[model samples]
Target: METLKGKTAVVTGSSRSIGRGIAERLAARGALVAVHYATNATAAQDVVEAIGKAGGRAFAFGTELGHEGDAERFWAEFDVQRRAFSDDGDTGVDILVNNAAVALRDHFQDATVADFDRMVAVNIRAPFFIVQHALDRLRDGGRVINISSAVTRLGLPEVIAYGATKGALDSFSRILAKELGSRGITVNVVAPGYVDTDSNADWLRHDKDAWEETAAKSVFGRVGEPEDIGDAVAFLASDAGRWITGQHIDASGGTRM
Candidate 1:
């Protein structure tokens, strides 16, 4: 079950919520994890400490993946973290979980140029380059899991921009799977629907009746938890998923028709 033992993982935007959940899961499975945060060192450090307390190895890394120079900074920081922690260089990465993303509430007509640009930068640009940078470090039988959203298939109107970016990523992941399949590298997308994270839980409590009504639509009868998606991502990043590639699997409690 320790398919990820002695492996290295870089989980971006991992200081909180789903990213943090994914990082913790990977570490628990015996992988050394690099936790990347945009600006909150304290939160990232907290996550690192939590992982350590649970008998896992983890380190905090900072990067503003939404900006121009952030990508280079991310890799440079990662190299330092990896080398300092893995002196023998035998702990090179075999798993890359693209979990970092930005989301803003905006209607299509009201979304500004800056809004669109920023989302694209973090959601699309960052993952693209991060994967490129980590390619050399990834072993032949590596795994690349992109965190996508149900909005791509749901086509929610207010989330046009966000959904578009995820759609593009879905396309990118499929093509990448084809390109890297020969090298034993697998690329896949995991799309989750309406996960009950900190923010959503608060909002849902305020509208209990509405939330219940919405939950009734799904066969699962409840919103998703971070652990739900984390488990799915871990499965894909494991040897059990070696034959799966170039596919977008919905982890949505069967909500979409």
Candidate 2:
């Protein structure tokens, strides 16, 4: 069933990994997807082509986040692509997925001020302002899904800054849910634990023992996959998840449970 037949979705950092998975899944469900990327134009185009080959609609938009006027730049490019993609001249979006993020691995003492600021800019500030700038474009009864991390609950000293940013993101979702409730716009967070994406290939894929330890963290005895997180976001972006908002859905495979 094409539940999202006439809707439009915007997924940030969707060139590869989890964001790519989410964008593909949403497009598969018949949503006209705007695949947002930071720098990799080729990778972003690959995503758009893949979606088209799958009989889904998608377009790529590039705007580097974590810098001045990042949100504005993204929206400007998004407007252009959305207008071109929409057949009925409808520019309103039905789903907004804030999946773009930067992961910083550093213990508190080794974490530099610049590193902290960069993390904040990408993870927290970007999403905050993106939503702020998207209010007019987002239609009533829309969905806002923020991609968060399990480190917010699990004490991961190595990624303290990254975890802190997700913590703030969760708080942002809770508050935004209330503020947007009247418009029937549901806001929520999906926190994934130890997904095996390219970003973690160096440590998770290369070291067998290290991989086992990370896999053991989940009750399922396996590391999470990109589809695991993508499926969770797909549910929230659908009508079935209408009643679920102002909440955190842990797509962590029972990690730390």
Candidate 3:
């Protein structure tokens, strides 16, 4: 339907998995997508090729988050690349999806200080500053969707620290929504549960018992897919979601319900 025709979107950590799904969906809706990756130039380019083959426009950008000046550098790179695809001089972003994060599977007792710091830096600090740095480039009516985890609401012993970071992101979104309301910008969070992505493939693909256990968390008796979460994000980025902001929309397929 081209609901997002003539829009520009940036999806972080979009080289693979859930981020890739979101990037593709936004492109399919007619938005020119900037797929951000921390490393792995090959993988990022693969995503761009896939999108192009599917009749979508996209470009890949590599920037390591969780470091000083990274966010500013990211925008600079985006601005240069965006001009290549844009005929008009408009380099502002219409949608910003902060989907990059670091997940440390360390329990409260097992978590190391280093692990916690890395997670906090990547998951919380990066997104926080990413948004702050993007304020000037974000269109007045832009959409900000920060990907969170269902673990924030549910009890996940393995990723307790990781979940906390997402909780913080949710809080940030809520306040930012109110703060940006006057500008007509919408900020929201999308939390996913037990998604079957490459990050989980090592455990899920090898062990049938473990896979079943994870899938059973959802009332639908199945694990969530990248597209499932992507669909939710697409809705939030659409004009239909204009009335909604400062909300946490669960894309977990009724997990633990």
TM-score of each model, paired residue for residue:
0.94, 0.97, 0.97
The per-residue C-alpha lDDT of model 3 at residue 256 equals: 89
CA lDDT, candidate 2, residue 189: 98
Tell me the tens digit of each residue's lDDT in model 2 across 1-257.
57788889999999999999999999888898999999999999999999999999999999999999999999999888877766566778899999999998999999999999999999999999999999998999999999999999998899999999999999999999999999999999999998888999998899999899999989999999988898899899999999999999999999989
Q: Least lDDT summed over 10 consecutive residues: which range in candidate 3?
A: 80-89
lDDT of model 3 at residue 182? 95
- The clash number for model 2 is 0
Better of 2 and 3 by lDDT: 2
Kindly report which residue stretches of model 1 are placed more than 4 angstroms away from their true locations once superposed: 89-91
RMSD over all Cα atoms, model 2: 1.1
- Clashing residue pairs in all predictions, respectively, total 0, 0, 0
- How do all the candidates rank in terms of lDDT, highest first? 2, 3, 1
RMSD (Cα, Å) for all candidates, in order, is 1.6, 1.1, 1.1
TM-score of 3: 0.97
Number of residue pairs clashing in candidate 3, backbone atoms closer than 3 angstroms, sequence gap of 3 or more or interchain? 0
Per residue, candidate 3 scores C-alpha lDDT tens digits across 1-257 of 68899899999999999999999999999998999999888999999999999899998888998888888888888877777766677878899999999887998999999999898888989888889988888899889999999999998898999988899999999999998899999999999998989988998978999999988888999988999998899999999999999999988989988
